[model samples]
Target: MTGHHPRQAVVTGSDSGIGAATALLLAAEGYDVGLTCHEDTAGVRATAAAVEERGQRAVVEVFDASRPDAGATVDRLAEQLGGLGVLVNVAGTGHTDRVVDLPYERWRQVLATDLDGPFLCAQRAARIMIAGGHPGRIVNVTSVHEHLPRLGTAAYCSAKAGLGMLTKVLALELAEHGITVNAVAPGEIATPMTGIAEEDAYREERPGNPVGHVGHVNEVASVIGFLVSPRASYVTGASYVVDGGLSLMAAHGHDSATGWRSLS
Candidate 1:
């Protein structure tokens, strides 16, 4: 198994958005995919149908990422898929409340889902890969907020930043075992989470972003596909920013003299 590459992959939060796109893309690339969703049973089924239409096996599961036993869900999915050689951590929650107005429970929920969940899932997947003596890929879906601070998303930012560090640490620790860990940070993607529809991505105007439009989910998915593909075998412990240059507007964002303090 030293030189073998497993063709089975698991993607969390695959009910929609980047997760669904990633599952579909991986299936197209000849990997059987295991899809998971928290509450969107119908959405996950839809994703599965699309995967099967592409002639690849797709298994669906429903589990809350904020739960302590989320890692168990990964293990079950891996077992069902025969084995997991690629894991994409995409299940996460967002917050818009300022720190002072934020509730402790909400903070905990965001951190648990965005940070703790990925840790648990990655740990389980790494164990499976090591035990099977196979090289593996783990890609965590963070956000541009992971590297930049925002006005009202204190919890979301903190959690994503933590996950980014976790990615690097895992990459260093797992390198000797032939496992690569990386993070993909996206900005203003045309996903349900961003309140943007996939079909309207190109039509949506985002003047602040260099691309001048919202990003399509596939743009981010393509990067993840590359990270998990054989072509990126030497890439690890890196964070790929798929923001259409949105993060680069930090200086421009601050140059504004009007309503800048209230900017999100």
Candidate 2:
């Protein structure tokens, strides 16, 4: 299969952060990677170089996953790579406006990027995988917000929650084809998305996290690497939470400002 390139994968929003880490890991695992980034051309190029350094071919494209042409990019990448063996949906946007004040356009933008984008990309990838007889892996990068409601994150929470459910449904549908579908829910990963500097080696202490610190993109990518590997053949329809026990604190209530306990 073209020397050592035995498999191929398409990862969206892979210019940086968890997406970039996943791409690098997959590349190191000997999969030629196709990546999409909206604005960070330099970051995308760096990721491509990293993949090549790992001895895997890399293709980069500028893609806005929220657009109608989102799926087209996946299809194109898959075509260029000859076929598809993995699809990781990491392209998404988050909105922190309160529901009461959230503009309709903003809500739509978040949902379009986080939910519709994944669905469209997955749909195209699934068709290619099924048609090409490639038992593929589909991993959607959701968030802890998929399971827990966060303050001022109505749109993001809703989109990720919908993506979690979509992963399960896709898993069920694709199982007959031997294709696995899953989600990786990361919480507070140290990435530019979280306002963390790329050069800074910082870990914020979280009282709720048993791990006692924020996660690194590679930590979440390691989980994704496993999920997409042959070792995870039997694992599907699952949402792996990489939050380091942050979700477990849901039972711990917060002090109330109105004399009643708040479950914040």
Candidate 3:
């Protein structure tokens, strides 16, 4: 493997939320991480500092995975960091509004970041890891919406679903090369990106998921950590769900979040 001791793991959109949590956890597990903050320098530095605290190396980089220049950006970062081994594609965007009401530009923007960005990042990372002749792991951060449909989020749901299939295809294609590809499809997770705080009117108005609440960033990151770790060497081409069983909970008529446990 390429630089396993200082374990190089590149995580996109790592400035905050699940990306940040994942990097911090991976670093604590002895993986030196390459972190990308779209524009959150302070948050990025904080994440890097946490990685350093774990006695692992951390490199913070400015990266916009959605851009056409993603390949070059990743290449430069990999070269500077010595060798790239693990890739966590956590960069994405979401959408709101019914499909008909959604603007064409907005739809394109969501797909560009959520689907295209991860594809680009993974392709570049795969090339480096394969060329280095290292056993590599690539994990795409998908969503519960990958399989479950959500109203007013047609673009997000569609892109995520496609990303899931892409994960499977990539896994199949890369199996011969010793690179593992998988996805972590999380449900409603508590994060800054979701605009999901108790103070948010939208959240307050729409309080509670089928599980009575949403998941935490760490909850999603932990599974991703395991998937990219050596412990999951045999695991690939899979999309693990961390939705607090909400995906399976048919609580459509059960509107109240407090009624989660009453399903049984």
TM-score of each: 0.95, 0.92, 0.89
Per-residue alpha-carbon lDDT of model 3 for 38-124, expressed as tens digits?
A: 889998999989889889888878887667877676787688779887889998888778988999999888888889888888899
Worst ten in a row by lDDT for model 1:
254-263
Model 2 C-alpha lDDT per residue in residues 1-264, reported as the tens digit of each score: 111112999999999999999999999988999999999999999999999999999998899988987899998998888888899999898867988999999999999999999999999999998777658899999999999999999999999999999999999998888788999999888888888754442347665566667888889999999998878888999999999887876555563323223334
Off by over 4 Å in 3: 1-6, 197-211, 251-264
Ranking by lDDT: 1, 2, 3
Which of the two candidates, 1 or 2, achieves a greater TM-score against the reference?
1
- Candidate 3's displacement at residue 3, Å, is 12
* Candidates 1 and 3 compared by lDDT, better number: 1
After superposition of all CA atoms, the RMSD between model 2 and the true structure is: 4.2
Ranked by TM-score from best down, the candidates are 1, 2, 3
* Local distance difference test scores for all models: 0.93, 0.88, 0.83
Which residues of candidate 1, in runs, are more than 4 Å off? 254-264
